[model samples]
Target: MNLVSVQDLIEAGRQVSLTGSALAEQAKKGTPKQREYLYGLLVAGVEGLEGFRLFFRPFPRGSRA
Candidate 1:
């Protein structure tokens, strides 16, 4: 597996955050199509981040109970 470096992860986070912020701005303008696209991007970004976190961190504690 290709390991992601800290810098790579940071850059990805920054890009996703910026995209989400732009999407929010578009959403505030009430453009339905833009809003939909923005929502999709936001969801993908969130899922990508969650996957990254899961890959780097240990499983949640107390889950085995």
Candidate 2:
């Protein structure tokens, strides 16, 4: 499997953080459509991070080779 670099993960985390912060600010005064957009970003960010986590985590010792 191809390994993801630490820098790449850091950049992804930064992007997600910025997007989440922006979403929070917009949510304070956003319209229904804007809220939906922000929600979508939030979900995408979360799922993306989870994917990265699973990708980087070491395999279990007892798992098949």
- Per-residue lDDT of 1-65 in model 2, one digit per residue for the tens? 23433333334445667544544554656665655555556558978888999888988899965
Question: Candidate 1: how large is its RMSD?
Answer: 13.2
Question: Model 2: which residue pairs collide?
Answer: none
Per-residue CA lDDT of model 1 for 33-53, tens digit only, reads: 544554556557978888998
Where in model 2 is the C-alpha error above 4 Å? 1-25, 59-65
lDDT scores of the candidates, listed in order: 0.55, 0.58
Number of clashing residue pairs, candidate 2? 0
- Reference-based lDDT, residue 1, model 2: 29
**Judged by lDDT against the true structure, how good is candidate 2?**
0.58
Best by the lDDT measure = 2
My TM-score estimates for the predictions, one after another, are 0.47, 0.51
